[model samples]
Target: MPVSRRDFLKMAGLGLVGSGLPATPLKQIARNVTTDNAASMLYDATKCVGCRACQVACKQRSGLPAEPDAQGLYETPRDLSANTWTMIKLAKENSEISFVKNQCMHCLEPACVSVCPVVALEKLESGPVIYHPERCIGCRYCMAACPFGIPKSQWEENLPLIQKCDFCADRLAKGEAPACGEACPTGALIYGTRGEMLGKAHARLASDKNYIQDVYGESEVGGTSMLYIAGVGFDALGFPRLKDDPLTAITWPYMKAVPAVIAVMASLSTAIYFRTHRDKGKQNGEEASDGSKD
Candidate 1:
């Protein structure tokens, strides 16, 4: 869904090509040591009742306006957008049903950060992948590079920018939980340190026989600040199956070499331009000299 003018204004109030080279070694990526203590949230889908309180809270906290449907009657967003950062989705499996929350996964080795040429997207030591709008150039590489399809553009605005969850960095800094987590009345969403969240998820999986025995975002794409567990298959909830390896491991060297490649191309172009222009100037000079002799 497209964002409204009011939503755009509210957000205003508040807020890459690779070169040919060997891929960077995975061991050298240097995972942040603070990730263990970084703020994280665990979403237990089994406990969710599709209340949408979290969604409403997110909109209020982010100062985003309601986005209506195509009919313009109800504020029903089908997926994440520049206006709607976090949302609730439903998944059905067999005779059971579950509610799934969709938002930024905030990957530890974020492909968006790796692909962004301007460093507009940054992964913080505290686990939030924050965006610097002033630094963004509207390349939308982050939109395409995100495995979860989280980042979205403000298509309705005259000057559009990307938007997504920041894990409520301001609240984190103030020693508070995210608005969405705090709004969940059912205890479906639990907030804690990444280490603590992971441990809790593991404990629940071991204790409860109903859980799928898998923790989404625990290791996918080298882990994420947001974790999830459901009784149904993750695929049913629209979770993509991914390897533990971070995507940056493969994209780093090429991204790192982009400046060098651009420099070489610029030099070649300059050389060709100067060489052709100089020859043309010399020919013009000789022609003038011959005309004078005549």
Candidate 2:
């Protein structure tokens, strides 16, 4: 009536052996309407004057409310928040000051898109990572997945949504640039195709020997639509130390394996339940046969 270790091993083998096959290649869903053209934003920190006008512009365009101070004054946020989709953070090093605008990097292979269980975060062909709140179950998995910590949650409301910069997708649909790009006065933030932006970033670095040799986001997290050129080191400008691999590439294999693991677990559980029940039934039938013989 007792099951041996070998039986357990055999059952486990039946449940899991040959079940560790690789996942099928994910279907290539066209993310953007325009395949040939990719939307991108270029941020040259050397030219940024720390005006924070883009932050204001984002709020104005998005219909977001201004954050109020204790004194009820409308003070601009120092970091991206639920109310502020974009912000300018100040960094000082070697007696020099630079303003680093913080917003969504919008990676070509976005981790958020890979990790979202409900398909709430989507990578658009227009090169923005957009969040659909109606589909969101208010889980903050996207926040944990993002290397830049871009997506913020609106915790004040009973029903909240994950908020982040969408690269102004609506404006792009109307053939207009994003509000942040339009608000940048010194041409620090430029909007163009990803290929063109990379070229410009390299040209600026080459022209000015004073500029940092590296272009942030060109290769970081498997390339981002939003690129940055800084006079100072990128670390001084609050750029995260990201892996060279695409964020999604680092996470997708594990995510894809989860369903298989779940299926195996379910099958093993059912097998164990039926085996136990069948043994119990046999024991009961044997006891009744013995009583009849007596």
lDDT of 2 by residue, 1-294 (tens): 143433444555565644333223333333342522689989999899988889889989999998877787767575788888888888887888888888998888888888889999898877778888789997799899788888889989888899999889989988899999999999999999887888899999999998889989877767788999988888888888775556564356567789877998999999998887887977788789778755
Whole-model Cα lDDT per candidate? 0.87, 0.81
Candidate 1 clashes between residue pairs 3 or more apart in a chain or in different chains: none
Off by over 4 Å in 2: 1-36, 258-294
Worst 10 residues of 1 by lDDT: 15-24
Error of 2 at 181 (Å): 0.4
Taking all chains together, each candidate's TM-score versus the true structure is 0.78, 0.78
* Candidate 1 residue spans exceeding 4 A from truth: 1-33, 70-73, 256-294
